[model samples]
Target: MKYVILIHSNPDPWGHPTSRYTAEGRALSEEQHEQGDRAFDALLEEISASGELVTGEALADPASSTVHTWTPEGHLATDGPYAETKEQLAGFFLIDCASRQRAEELAAQFAGPGSVVELRPAMWSGGDDQ
Candidate 1:
């Protein structure tokens, strides 16, 4: 099965890899931040070696995002994210795992104090016609 791990976080003073240096990131102790980084690195290495990691990437700031919506007149373009929530999608990891439980286990590693992690099965993965 293929799953996508969606990572969401507050975009104000956004920082990468669990918001290590931002004000929100500062909520954690320095030791906790370092530990998170090490854990993330270990997870990446493990998944890559197991051939479960298909691809992963971090997104640009929400301020650089553009939203497009279809309308009767034409396509409408907006300046920011599609949602008005405090947390916005910050990154994602696509993985080919053995089962939903296994995917969930991996997804848990991405969650932090304030970050939100979502795991969803991919209906259409790469090289699939149906």
Candidate 2:
């Protein structure tokens, strides 16, 4: 089975979870920052070594995002993000696993103090050679 892990968080100066910029996220010292970085790196390495990581990436700032829609008159374009919320979609990981339980286990590592990780199965678009 193939799964996609969606990461979400509020816009942070240093970045979500890592909180490299904010004093609170820094936890009053550089030690917290380094530890957070290592934890994330370790998670990636663990998944990669297990051969479950297909691909993953962090997204750019949400303010730079754009939205498009069709109106009765014509097509419309607008600045995004379209949703109003404290948290926003930040990134994702694509993984191939043997079962949903396995995928869930992998996604658990990404759940942090200020971040949310969502696991969803990838669906085929049809017209496949299979």
Candidate 3:
């Protein structure tokens, strides 16, 4: 089974590895932050060695995003994200794992203190659904 772990966090003061130093992340102590970093790195190493990690990437700040919509007249383009919310899609990890339970377990560890992690089964585009 293939699963995608979507990472959501506040876009302000953009930071990597699940926004450990951003908005809500500020509530945690430096030691806690370091622990989270170490844990994340270990998880990545474990998954990669097990051949479960397919790919992962961190997105740029939401301010750099562009929204495009189709209007009756033509196309409308605007700067910034499509949604006006505190949390936005920050990054994602695509993993090909054994089962849903295993994927969920991995997602639990991937989730940071101040970030929201969403795990969903990935669908194939070519009419071959799993």
Residue 64, model 3: lDDT of: 87
Give all candidates' CA lDDT scores: 0.84, 0.77, 0.85
Per-residue lDDT over 1-130 for candidate 3, one digit per residue giving the tens place of the 0 to 100 score: 8999999887357777555656667778889888878888899999999999999999988888999999999999999887788888999999999889999999998777678899988997774354
lDDT assessment of candidate 1: 0.84
Write candidate 1's Cα lDDT for 95-130 as tens digits: 999988899999998887668899988886464432
List pairs with backbone clashes in candidate 1.
none
Candidate 2 residue-wise lDDT at 106: 85
**Tens-digit per-residue lDDT, 44-129, candidate 2:** 89889989899988887778889899999999989988779867888899999998888988898876656678998888876332
Model 1 TM-score? 0.88
Model 3 misses residue 114 by how many Å? 1.4
Q: Which stretches of candidate 2 lie over 4 Å from their true place?
A: 14-18, 21-24, 126-130
On TM-score, the stronger of 2 and 3 is 3
